[model samples]
Structures are given as structure tokens and as C-alpha cells.
Target: MYGIVLSRRDFREADQVITILTAEEGKREYIARGVKKIVSKNTSHLEPATLISFGIAEGKKEFSYLTNVQPVESFFHLRQSLPTLHIIGYSLDALFTMLKEGEADSDIYQLYISYLRFLNTQEQVRLLLLDAFLIKLFSHLGYHPSLDACVVCEKTYKEIGLEFLSATEQKPGFYFAGGGIICASCKAEKQRIGEVAYPCGIKEINTLRFLLASSWQDVVSFPLDEEEYRLVHKLIYEFMLYHSERKWDDWGKISLIMT
Candidate 1:
């Protein structure tokens, strides 16, 4: 079937090694052999974030080849602004790195398309959109954070200080570690590093909770104040890093692009 071009790497002087998020195959990479030919119309149409219909031939194992492609939604607005183009580019790259090839993830494809469409809008709320996109994307990948109740004690985060274990801290700042909170009581039970709780305000936690719990369509239109928006931006970055277990270089850059 056809899909959107998520990412592309130059394979040669005149060809591109690319990955497409297909409805049938999820994410697949192939050599767009000779796509860069001077007279080839296909090469011009395969930009990142451009929706295109592509025919694929299943191969031996864990790979596929592209037979043909037709443009669908080009997301032309993404090209109008450099900062926007960069943020969306990084988001697409993150997806490319995080998703496995030949896996069927229709949900991810839909979320990605939604994110692209949202980004194409002329709203000055780029950071808000980025934060919302991360929360939705991470939730889909099963790395969603515990933003409501205390992850360790299973108690509602009523108090101002909500501690969580820090994965990489020598004297871990809070009880947050590896996707959950380690309560003060639970902290003593474990021999690992621990630290007292930090103040994670109710509003901050609630915003995260709402983002995780709500649908993208519903959440996209939701608004955020500057402080709340900044909290989400930081939380999602930490959440992605903590959950995915990988360092994303472009994430910080995307945050800066919005600023």
C-alpha cells in the first residue's frame, strides 16, 4: 500500500535511501534507485513529511522494496518556515529511530500524520504542539509517565512535593526512576540511591495527566499558559529520555527552535 515518507538519507549522487511509514507494512526502508535523475519526477515528490502512495514488494526477511509512489498531502506549509520545518524534521527523525522496520503500527502512522497536520497550522504555539506531540507519541509507545498519583506509594499526588527516582543521578534528586515514583518509605527498602521529593505542582502534573489521557484530536485544540507549557516541554523530554533509554540529540535543538 501507500504511505508517508518519514525520512530519507542520500544513498548516492543521484539516489536516496529512504523510509516510508506504510499503512500495510508500518515502517520500511528502501533505495529509491535513480530517484534523483534529472528528469525523474518521483525524486522531487519524496520530501520528508510529504504523504505519498507507494507500492512495495515484500522481500526475504524484515525488508521491502518500493515499486512506485504518488503524492498525497504534501504539507506544503512546513516549507514556509525554517523553524517549523526543523522541528517537524527532528520529530520525524525521532520516529524513524524509535520505530522498528516491517512492524505494523497504524496508530503511530495516524499520530504522525496528525502531528504533521497540526504543525502545518499558522498558530504561534509551536512549543505547545511539540509538547502535546511528545506526550501522545510516547503514550502510544508505552513509555507514558505516571503523572497523576505517586508511582511508588500509589497515593494521589495531593501535596506539592511529588518525589520520583532519578535514573542517572548519583544522589538521585527525587523518587522518580524508571517510569515510577519511589516513596520515602519505599526508598529505605531499596539499597539503591535515593533522594527526597521535589515539588511537582498539581497543575503541572494535571496537565501531563490530561495530555496522556486525552486523544490527540481533543488535546490538540487544548490551550496552555507559558508556565504550564514549559513544564510539559521539560517533562516530555525527560520522559522520552528516561523511557526510551536513548539520548536524543535533536530534542533539545527542537525545543530551542521554538524559542
Candidate 2:
């Protein structure tokens, strides 16, 4: 089976427990004995986030042994950029959390590899690769937002605004939690009933629309101004946090490293 190394950790004296996202199995764990030795044969071939082809010998229902492993792509460029590495870490964590053991998702594997290659570019464009990656990943996971039309009235979002509940006050700002835009009528209705307090503008609305509609390559090519980039980043991060219910702690260390 072919897989990408998702994570690895020490298990015993000379063994390491490794997790991989494979084409045959969605995600699986294996114990590679004697992997810590300096002269270990598989030591260089097994690296977190590298593409690898391996043969697995199933020992029990829960785990397996990595009998043979061949490196396919190391993504060496990602090592030089701390932010890109952090983004990859966050993405892999999200995938690992949602993926089920023994399930096959070949399409997801292909999408992942393609996205990674795109991310290795030298362009350094403003649209956060992390944000694009999350949106694309969610699309694959079937949680993609309905941006073609309004979530309330089902009308095309010709031009819409965004509302965000501030993280500090827990106040409902401007957002349509159901799917797409919350029309003026619905916004007024909610405010009349004391459901929300304030309004957030539509300056970034078109950018959101473009993001939802654009291809991955187009998104990477488009340049995002500072404000829009920051807004989109926050939105993607918030959406993921709300849906996954998982706190991402490593992000802070990653940010520090990048700075």
C-alpha cells in the first residue's frame, strides 16, 4: 500500500510507533522495531509527511508492522519555510482526527499530494495556503459551504457581506451558520429578536465568493491584500475549530518559529 507518513513517536528501546495515511487504509499505525538504530535500514525512508510506498503485514486488527518502505517524495522545500510546515502540520492533524481506520480514500490522497506540490511554489502569494488547504479539504470531507446561493432564501449571493461573532465578547456579529449569506431581511429579523448586536461589512464578501468558486491553482495565483488575507485566515481557522472541536496548540510554536 502507498501512504504518507502522518506522525511518529518513540515506543520502546529501539522501536517507533508510526502513523500513516494510506491509499488502501485511510490511516493506520505501525510499530517499526529497531528503527532508532543508527544503521537502521528504514530509518531514512520513514519520515513524517513524506510520500512512501510500503507493504504492511497486519498483526492484529488495531496495528501492523511496516515490512518494507520506499520513499516517493520528501517535499524537501517545505523544510525551509516554517509557516508552510505549520500549515501542513495543522492540515495533517485535522485529517488524522477525522479519518477512520481501514477506510479507503484514494481521491483524498491524490488531492493531498497535488495541494502539497502547489504549496511548494516560490511565489509566496498572500492567500494563506493553510486557508486554501482547509477549504479544499473540507470540500473533500463533504462539509463544503454552499456559496453559490444564500443559505436562508436560496438566492444567488450576487454581492454579500460577512458577519463574525467576536471571540472576546461571544456576541453574535454577522454570519449565516446554516450555509451561505444571511440576507438583510433575515439579519433584521434576528436582530429584532435580540439574536445579534452589531453588523460586519461586506468588504471581504467578494473575496469569499471568489475563494469558494476558484480552482486551487487560481486561488494560489490570486494576491490577497493584508486585511482580506487576515480576515480569511481567521474565518478558516474559526470554522475548523467550531466543526472539529479540537484545540490546536502547536500553532503558537509554529508562529513563533516563523517570526
Q: TM-score for all predictions?
A: 0.78, 0.80
Using TM-score as the measure, which candidate wins?
2
In lDDT terms, how accurate is model 2?
A: 0.66
Please state the error at residue 147 of candidate 2 in Å: 1.0
Evaluate all candidate structures by whole-model CA lDDT and list the values in order: 0.66, 0.66
**How much does each candidate deviate from the true structure in C-alpha RMSD?**
5.2, 5.1
Instruction: Give the Cα-based TM-score of candidate 1 against the true structure.
Output: 0.78
TM-score of 2: 0.80
Compose the digit string of candidate 1's lDDT tens values, residues 1-259.
6688887887768778788887677877877767877887788678888998777676666545566778888988777887777678767877887888889888888888877787777554355556667767777777766654456666555432433333212221124463644334444544344443433344556677777667555565677766676655665676676667577763544544543
Candidate 1 positional error at 25, Å: 1.5
